[model samples]
Target: MNKSKIVVIGGGTGIPVLLDALRKENIDLTAVVTVADDGGSSGKIRNAVNIAPPGDLRNVLIAMSDMPQFYADILQYRFDETDGPLAGHPLGNLLIAAVSEKQGSISTAIRTLGRFFHISGNIYPSSDQALTLHAVFEDGTEVAGESSIGKHEGLISHVYLTDTDTGGAPIASQNVVNCIMDADMVVMGPGSLYTSILPNVVIPDINKALLETKAKVVYVCNIMTQRGETENFTDADHVRVLHEHLGKKVIDHVLVNIEQVPQDYMDNNAFDEYLVQVKHDFAGLKEQEVKVISNNFLRLVKGGAFHDGEAVAREIMGLSKRQAD
Candidate 1:
């Protein structure tokens, strides 16, 4: 069977897990990652080097890399010297920083590294520029950075790019458009509602392509709600926010988790949990004309909630087959 071309739009931790699972199947995958991250090692590099953030890109790359001997750990390696100028930084991010300087473009740097790592899939930033996200709180306070908005304690009124019409990696935009034009399926989310997922769709040209694409648009709803990001978001709330960003008619399918989590887990991570224990409203999705596919998406662990990569891969593969039929 010929591989189905798939374009997955998202960023950060969730994207890599999804990409890792999807790459294991016989499919062509393109990950369009967000560049608005101004936190952790990615933020440091972006602040110092004035280039696209590499943390998200690096995570996606490692996720899509061939396993057993790949640079997954190396890419995620953080300096712990605790006393040096270069301490507390991730090596992969720094490598990207170095490459961006030498190559003079993030796209060039990542492309060069992609070949080096023997990555089977493509990873791209939603934009090539180092951009900040701007949002106003419902309480009338304005927030400028993604990290700051995340830490704020109010609902967001609306969100947009800081430099309207400025800072996009044209190559990434073109890549996303091409992927959409050629894809059998284009999937978004299952990541952070505001930060990881919406950043890609908010881009003008990218959203236009999404609207115009002939591909089936599927939105994977987050398994948890994020504090400050989607404080009161339900499965319906997540889809609504997406439609608010991409228009109502743009999304075709919504993938949601049906497995119920323990209340203890919910209470413990209440401040940090993105997906609460609230029962998802199926009627809400039906009202939006969005088809919902429910499955067991939760993975219980020692310290965090995670999507079962293998299970997610199986689900996506099944969805692809259904689309083919």
Candidate 2:
């Protein structure tokens, strides 16, 4: 009656939603979060303290924590502009930064915070050092920084990590690689393909481990297209990009949403960052030899579309069982 080992990789809001659901299941969960974020409270803190961005890690920690509602609220509390220099910064980000500085590494700080919050799952930053996400546009122009990649108007040619001379590329810690290699199942995305998910996998060691792992790798496709990142990307197109980057047939299953989004439910002006619903591409998926699990995995909240975490988790559990069988 051993629990299955599941390693979820990615960053941003989508990942936390998935983790929130996964935490309720009987599994050994480990969240390997991206550290390429250089915007908002995370960016400010990282620049000032020279540490990995902790915003994604904080969200993932809270999602898997067994703490009371009040504690979660306190960690996520944000200050207003009236608060001066600390304006718009979440309390958790500052705390993580302080702990990272004190402990001499983000990995240690994350573990300390996890213990403090009584997290149900393990959390690891993709890298110990701060990594910058650099992208080359289709026109050969290049943009540096995860926050700035979306601002470019051209299609992204490819993205790679900079700011390190270690083989001239950013690298993942050995601990992160070992977790992936040992997992029974590895889940990727439900987040921004380029910024959130790919930033973690593109690390040479991680990419190599993904190819070597015996785990059932599952990719949860986004329900909608992101304006700057994946403007018109289809479900299959998403998988294709991943395959191209990882340079192998690592993905075993792709969980996609087939439920149609209501035309008017999405307020473009309010959610201007999101462009359109991600088009279904079963044919393309078939061509890629990826087993497609399509279902009504949509949950609408406040005029925006999101993955139904419980539904997605159920599918993941089924996949794990099937793999075991």
Candidate 3:
């Protein structure tokens, strides 16, 4: 019997948490990470070297590595401003950028590092080239760059890649499309909706592969609404936006947190980017024809609310089993 093949799509802190848990499972795992980031040390490196942002990819790689924790820590270590040329950059990001330059592509570099780190699963960038996320606001104003989108006060009408002059439709690598098409289950999100997850799916080939694939599509909704991105958004609103972009109800299951967050547990100073808990909309989710898997998926740690990765992984494994049966 073959192990179940699961493909997870997203970037940022959330996906890495989930990946860390899933790596222990007896399954074939593939991670499709977004490369549209242009912030912090990643932004600086991208501007300086014209490479895809390595921040998220670096985290994902570390999560999947079976190497010693000390090595992972070394890779994640950051240099302060006092470090001169290396200041503000994490060691992992710099290594990935260096390998990408040497290998001549981000995808090749990721594979090379995956072997070096003995990563448990595959990691592929959604695109090989650098991508800029461009959003059009409700007032018809436009904002360019993934880092800049959240700062706008107005509601976002929609977002697209600015890589092309024709339609701004970004392209995904064949490996990315093939992973989605071949997986037994494809998991989306647990990350920023617009910037993290959407950037990967908005690519025409990827969206089409998702619609065409027979794999069970599961969306892991965020535990909290993002301040500048998804303030006051309900569970259904998250699914709705995904469907609106895909042009159909492609989501088969939505894993949502049913547990209530403790009122004072959240420290705004620590989690300044998070706004409030995402409201539940069971009826609305049903209206969209998505099977809702609501559970106590909350994990509160260090004054921040997050998904319990093990619990979520169990549910995902169950879904994969049912799909196989």
Candidate 4:
């Protein structure tokens, strides 16, 4: 018997949460993170080093690693904004950038770190080059850059990517296609639909592999709608958008949160990106013929909503175990 190989896809803070929990499962875990980040610390390094942004990669590595907490803290440490030459940059990002230059690609840098840091499983960037996300809004408007897409006020119609250095079509990072193709299951989301998860699947080779792979594709829907990306969207709408982009219904299962958030818990000042809770659409989901695993997957803390990663991980691994059996 072999360990079930599962590939978790997406980026941002959400993927790391799931990765942390999924690492505990008795299965083979691999994180296929998006490279289309151009925001804050990631943006700075992507510009300076002309490589895939390392912010998401850094978080994923930390989540997968069993290193001492003190070592993790040192890698995650940030210099004070008042300090010169090192302000706002995480030590992990610098380490990745240095290793990327030495190793010649972000994929190799991640591989090197994963082995040396004792990561539980694999972490691969979705692409080798730094990618810029471009969005076309419903109002006949276009925006470039991942950070700008969220800040720009308009209903996004679709999003795409281009190479940061040469403006060429984006290609799958080394091992990403093979991982997806070989997986027993592929997981998507709990991250930004447009700027994070979609960026990876929208890549030409990645998309092709997804279409050809026999693995079960599960979408972990967000608990809350994002202001700029998914405002006023129903749970089924999320799947619809993904289906539209992928040219057919590819996602096999969706994990939706059914529990309602208690009133007065959300602090808008701290977590401004999240808006109202996502509405349910069981009929719509049924119409798409996708399995809906609705549950009380919400974890409300410090005035914001998040998925209970352990709970979701349990569901995911349960499915994997059944398939293996």
lDDT of 1 at 299: 78
How high is the lDDT of residue 230 in model 4?
97
lDDT string, candidate 1, 1-325, tens digits = 7789889999878877888889878898888889889887788788788898898888887788784544577777889978486787888889989999999988778889888887787877777787778778889999888888888888987777754235433323577777877888898866887888887888877888888888898888877777788776778877777778777567888888888776666446433545465358888888778988888987777656777877877878898998888
TM-scores, each model vs. reference: 0.93, 0.97, 0.97, 0.98
Q: Candidate 1: where is the Cα deviation over 4 Å?
A: 67-70, 164-172, 266-275
What's the lDDT for residue 227 in model 4?
A: 86
What TM value does model 2 have? Answer: 0.97
TM-score winner: 4
Model 4 weakest 10-residue run by lDDT: 316-325
lDDT of 4 by residue, 214-306 (tens): 999999998899989999999999999998888789899999999999887899999999899999999999977799998889898788899
The residue-by-residue lDDT of candidate 3 on 124-207, one tens digit each, is: 999887888988888999999999999989777788785532336577889999988999999997899999999998888998
Off by over 4 Å in 3: 164-168
What's the lDDT for candidate 4? 0.91
RMSD of each: 2.4, 1.3, 1.4, 1.0
